[model samples]
Target: MNRRGFMKLMGSGAGLAAGSAIMGSTLVQNAMAAAPRRGGTIKLAWVDAVDTLDPHFTASLGSVKILNNIFNGLLKVAYDGKKVSFVPDLAETWEMPDDKTHVFTLRRGVKFHNGDPCDAAAVKWSLDRVKDPAVSSPHAWKFETLAGIDIVDESTIRMRFSKPYAFLPVALTGSTGRAGTIVSKRAVEQHGKAFGRNPVGTGPFKFAGWRENESITLERNPDYFEPGLPYLDGVKILLIKEPTAAVAAMMSGQVYGMSLSPFQFIPQLKANKNLKVYGEVEGNYSFVGMNNRRAPFDDPMMRKAVAAAIDRNTIVKQGYFGEAIPAYSCISPPMTGFYDKNIGNSGRGQRFDLKKAMEYRKQSKYQGEVNPVYIVAQGFTGSGGSGTRNSQLLLPMLEKIGIKPKIELLDRAVWTKRRNGGDFDMYDEAWIADLDPDETIYPEWHSGKPWNFVGYSNKEFDKLLSEAQDTLNQATRKKLYD
Candidate 1:
């Protein structure tokens, strides 16, 4: 089947199943009808502990999710059941004077947890901090086009870009987007290195306490700009790295919910009448990332050979257990306008043909003893098992085409360091794309960007990406990407 058709079928089935599950749960239906309950704390479990609360320094999903509750950006991305839309957050309204300049009218009377006013200066300060060399934020690439910030007045600020950037507003929407979250300059200056542990923001939640490797707590911001909101009194986030322990916690009512549960436990969880299993096809995919900087992979023919030998069906079945769809393009399916469905139709790539794999292998120049390609996997979360299973299944396929691979399981920190540093020949990993296509495509493919660890660079690809970012016409952008 075509990539588009396959994705549609998978998404529709998953959506229907999720709908049925929700409808069948009497507790969920009754809770939806009741008035917003207040003065109650909800405990949520995560597989990893938040490394930092500073949105600029956040690199993990756990950190980003927690920071979303304690921070506010100038704009926000609101995801309904069907689609995503950008909305005003700290800024009441905004306008574009030209293609390169955006003016925002700051909401008045919004104060930080430290009582600092949220105004034009604060916005400028927050953005400048992310760009500062000393801060060394992982998200600095998001602001590469930023030229300057002009404070028109106390309640207004104009952001100027070197060129037209259509995704700038979208990028500033949430913690998952760019590093546009506003922070209190006073609080950050006072706390310095300790600011992450003592976060201060203008969101629904305020940092209450954090016990290292145990839990992080946040209380409702009584003076939140949105009045009569944040119905929950507080939230307690427990760091439970073990999947079994997390499931046990949910069963025992120790935690109200889990951010992510293992797929293997989904059946048991769904069978329990007291619990609900929610499912959605996430805008993400797993892959065995080949380091193009190294030998063999540096050649396009060898890369094609490797791609043709492996079966995506086996990977999805063995690694994800039917939870994932086969990815064709680097961009995931959910992101509209960017994903090139035609790429999957090409017969030369992502098509498992042992004959073509053998032909390409024979055409390659590196006939000498090739070292076993190292595939690194993290030891925590379901990804660990997925990576292990993927490597095991991939071994025989590669062996059939005259290649060898070794799997290495490491802790999260070590795995991240090696992956970011390009120290491995291959790595089993996943990319969680932002709401915008530019955010997903740019950093990973733009030659000099730090996240492009694979070191795959092409002048033509770079030109198309630049033009796509500068052009306002969606058709033109799609053409360039395609």
Candidate 2:
């Protein structure tokens, strides 16, 4: 993809709206007007506690958000109004010699929290570590296109790809992708299994302490590359699971910010004169995943029936309180190019149709009961609780269509294992879009991929995706994706 295609793919109108809502907040506007002031402690509250500080191993958004403050990637994606752009972070400048080769000029004078030099070797180590089979990083799949990393000098490195991947730099963005975040090699070597607990990186803040379910603390990195950044002297992240308790804490001035706000509590928060609410439509979506590896779901008719039976509008209204948009395709709306708008609309394609659902169900050989599991992740509430609520709504709908299905709620860990291990007939699955469309589409839908827990396989779809990736022309890629 060219620069124009890259920007268009990343730019989502909903994402812009979300950013505007947050940035236009009273507090944010006031802060923007004032000169940078350093030395105040910001107490932020999160509904979930981070299991690890290591960015490579972190799969949860909660952990990734915290890791972002403590790690610096080669490049970062930033939104300017509705336009998505890539900015230099650890790597000050880069040049693409060819479609498959990217050479980056690292920024000098950068240091990891452990006092290790953030040089070309460090970047190589960090990238290679993710691909290391022994490490088994959750983000290893992001670097599958990476052929090799060669250190050209103390402050320069060359990245070779197997094919012409246009979104390599976009994939390196810190916020969404952790594969490019440079870590302290010495720190990892010394800590080994304990590295995640005592993580070190070249970020705005330094990891201080983590008290499991209580809190995680980070102090200002005095040796930070960007001068007088972070504004706050320290950051204290409080682990408050309950929405009511979190709102109470915020009301009482005990917490300055809440990371993932509950949708039901938004009206109450907006009503509070002293409080300010910031939000952005994130590039994420929740979906009902059918296990194609097993009977019933293995049949295309059964999958179609289930999809037709789901009342997305009701789920959006009741589960998300009208905060979320109903997703039609696998790709969310925030992903502009890849999203097929006609897929979920009435008359255009799949929608609530009990009659059609029953027709499709009758075509299936296995007409027995279907058991769907609802897995609840950390900080699950009104806004992010689509999985739990959507699954509940699906139960009666399935029954109405003469299909017997039982819903089981499982903890995140157990649910993840069962889903990945293919031990479920059906389940709720969600995804946050990476900087590129391939990040969202390829892994989940591609046959035999690890994240393709539903066991979905379509040779034609795979061929289209492969062609899209190999093609350099943006228009052709968009056509292929469409």
Candidate 3:
């Protein structure tokens, strides 16, 4: 597909990118990235570099390394053709009482890639390690309900929680969380730093080699419990930085598939008929986070006005090729288990209400322009860089609703640092697939939480979250949330 065709499928182009679009150069890079023969080789690009090798200490992208090959959880929920099924991977079977805790019968004769036997003792150790403050896992939120893990026997493991969590089974599949995945206690103590590179799991694939920022290779395990599986003999994950190149590779059939941010490459995907595109409307949501600790954003009325002024539907349709849904609350409605839909008006769509936004602005008693600054990655998929294209599309839309956004484009590294440090008027941000509302709200909206990037403090929200967590009645729990 051509560049214009790709953009049309994805919506309109903004700023300098619109006038001087280079379809040819983009196609060339795309071909180069995807070009490679397939047999035992599979070229996949990581969205970001791997952060750590150890699953317990996994604080970065390296968790992907552990996910595919090194670790095997108690159960496997495969998403095939939009349906989910529980398959045997680690745990053979499980039982739940009132949905608060899961008692799993561990699989027998499982071995870590390092040759350590995976047992109840090992499972206990692995779960405990996840809670270790030293790890400071990025997903520490997932463990909030984890009361403790009780080992019933050599082959039995029961995990009791602080309360009932409907998403428990789905949560286990998450990059974070201590579910049925059993790590070898012997391995962590033996090889701490080196273990990430050299690891073992009961999965069909085994560790082959990892060339940092280049590629990570793996080969099928001959002794894998499910023999004759992993259809491919081996796979290679290339670390390509650009999304355009990744798309090009996919179109050329250089690689089977690659993880791409939908905003940047959806159009190209729609244009390629030969290629298959698999996308899920993830429970993740992105919103304009204003630094509440900073200027006018500190004003509640201003925050409310900004929230009201945003026309989510227009942005969703134009920017995301109808692939995205406009969000009003921290959690999208699709994943709102027992939560009340009326708690907040999440139906806000893409309709500019300049008069309303200005009314709220006037109420806040803000000064001239209320020119909020927005930070985004400069690159198309944004490597650690700077540019105004992202802002160009957003600023005008915000202005149409009576908000003038002063753009502050920065390199990815600086942007990330500032965002995590809570130092901007507003920013473009999103969560990947957080299948639960607790996963969406607790860390993000709760006061004093690290992931609360906007510094939004709400005691009422916290109290509701606490109430929801302990309540056994699904209706009552959702009522508390609402």
Candidate 4:
């Protein structure tokens, strides 16, 4: 979804299954002292509704969280108790002959749930499908630099790019690693449009059944390639949309795990000794954005005024229940090498001052009545209420500074549509599992790009981003982003 903006996510594994799904494996990892037991059904409570099943098209974290169990990617995030590194998933090994070329050796015997061979031809078809214009996949941007794909052998393929792309390696495992998570070509052609609902992938668990607004089920693949993985015989994913009901389900032991847990309930969830909270740090963030090409916000001073009006610290304390750090920049702290650690204290950060905001507003060209048209969405599971609540808190803040704002709450689908179409003045946006700064800045901030609902355009920014993507060295890339 490019920079869907940033929402403080609960945990980030090198590569995690759904928020709750990854932790469900903890019970087995804990039992590893003796020998991990296999065969059980793990019940997961997901707070968001999932409409799309195909990885390449869906941007919902709720879908990604569950789909993580049902799809396999070319690469995945792995940790060695010390640091996170890229590890093989569908690809047993890969080689980089040059910055623009990659050679991948696919693991044989891997088969999609549909009994289709997941070979080099399938991989080529899958990647090409995502890039196809007819597909209109939101993730198509991830492959924009691709020059061509050549199947060298039955098990090998060489990918040549027109330019150096630093995001490719991590793009495979991005968020749920959708772009590189190969899909079944035969199944796609057979199911056509419904393929998303009836997806076929080479994952440990195969999609079993799903009910509208009820549950999604997955059964263990009897012929799983990873050997004894998917310890649980089946997974039952219940769609509990409300935060209150989801929490109640968790406290009542109705479900074995939960994903996208609301911040307000974190304290109670952590207090229970029977439950475990997996809050690993990942590079995810939540942000509020404005349509730069639209009225009022089109003025830089007006934008600065709005920025000064909202207190980031208060948002962290009240909105996140003190479970999150106030984000000063879009690039989160966990991204280390490129993150501007001192940006908060660099005499410029998210500010809160009615007086300054008023001054900036006074200097702006818009002398007419300010229209604080707020756009919020039912996105982020347990946190679906996130945008609505933030709207209530923010509208008042704007009103105090002589601005009148109204809430226009939209369903996730409509909200995404309207926002991406550049139809709003101000809106709540978020991005998750952003492995690199380029992934965070380039797509969403660049002029006229998808996810750039803000409609911000600056030749300088676009140029810098172009150089950053090609500059191979971390130090130089950081400088460019800076």
Where is the poorest 10-residue window by lDDT in model 4? 20-29
**What would the C-alpha RMSD of candidate 1 be, to one decimal place?**
6.2
> TM-scores across all candidates?
0.88, 0.88, 0.78, 0.88
**Candidate 4 Cα lDDT to native:** 0.70
lDDT of 4 at 271: 79
Local accuracy of candidate 2 as per-residue lDDT tens digits, 405-452: 666677667777887788877766656545567776676767766577
Worst 10 residues of 1 by lDDT: 15-24
Pairs that clash in candidate 2: 18-280, 18-281
| lDDT for 93 (candidate 2) | 97
Q: Poorest 10 consecutive residues of model 2 by lDDT?
A: 14-23
Q: Taking the tens digit of each residue's C-alpha lDDT, what string does model 4 give over 189-307?
A: 99999988898888888999888889989999987899768788999989887878978888888887877677677778877877777664454556667777767677777776777
Where model 2 places Cα greater than 4 Å from the true spot, the runs are: 1-36, 337-350, 368-383
Task: Please give the TM-score that candidate 4 achieves against the real structure.
Answer: 0.88
Q: Where in model 4 is the C-alpha error above 4 Å?
A: 1-35, 80-84, 353-355, 378-384
lDDT of candidate 1 at residue 25, scale 0 to 100: 10
